[model samples]
Target: MPETGDAAPDFTVPLANGDVDSFTLSERLEDEAPVVLAFFPGAFTGVCTDEMCTFQDRLAAFNDLDATVYGVSRDSPFALNEFRNQNGLEFGLLSDYNKDVIADYDIEMDFADLGVYGVAKRSVFVVNGDVEVTYAWVSDDPGVEPDYDEVEAAVEDAA
Candidate 1:
């Protein structure tokens, strides 16, 4: 997993909001803005819904801090778009359908009890304009969520 001060792995993935579009981490880095990558196991699940909704609720604060937030999951763009629309989320959701990003971030995990394999562990990474990690949080349990206040503080510092 990437630690603080380490370079965040760059990725180009399909971003789903109201419509599908391409998103590139490296390209966003050029804008010199703080980026928050929130990874969840799946979309439409209870915990995932709450986590994402929480981010949506806190979006204004993050925006005030000049930070961009993205929720990531191993779901198809169509499914993600539905999830975003249903949740009324303003931020984009990245479709890691191939699970490549999870592997790159070393956050791949399996939900043995659910018979699910190769899903992204719940994780949050704060990357500064320089593409370096300013904060990192990962949960072994899918039910866990990141500390919103801490993430806000991290983005504030990065900004």
Candidate 2:
């Protein structure tokens, strides 16, 4: 997990929209806009779907705070497309299939015991214009999730 106050690593990952785009953490933070980068384990999973749909349902609240929300996962673009379309996602759900972004953010999972492939631990980062992580939450237990109220408070403060 990236430490708070550290500069976020930037990466360009594939998008479900059939375009390769890059998200520069610092660039997003410019003009004091807060960026909510939510990394999930995979697509179509129970928790992941609920997590993303929660964001979709409250997207306007985030927008009101001038925040741009991004959902990142290791799923392929096709899978991401389906997930977004099926759930009526209004934000970009990026494809980090290669795990490069996951590595850069130090969110990779260990597959030794479960025999699962590399997965991103569920996490969220609130970044400022200078690329500093103003707030961050990485789940110690993969089964758990970040506190939405805490995150919303952070977003409000950042705004």
Report the number of clashing residue pairs per model. Answer: 0, 1
Best by lDDT: 1
**Model 2: lowest-lDDT 10 consecutive positions:** 17-26
Candidate 1: where are CA atoms >4 Å away? none
Candidate 2 lDDT tens digits, 1-159 = 678878778777776753446555555567646888899998888888999999888888888888888899999888888888888898888888899989998888865687877789999998766677878899856778778878888888876
lDDT of 2: 0.82
Candidate 2: segments with Cα more than 4 A from true spot: 17-32, 111-114
Each candidate structure's TM-score, on Cα atoms with residue i matched to residue i, is: 0.97, 0.89
- The residue-by-residue lDDT of candidate 1 on 39-122, one tens digit each, is 999999999999999999999999998899999999999999999999999999999999999999999999888899999999
lDDT of 2 at 96: 89
TM-score of 2: 0.89
TM-score, prediction 1: 0.97
Kindly state the number of residue pairs that clash in model 2. 1
C-alpha lDDT of all candidate models, in order: 0.94, 0.82
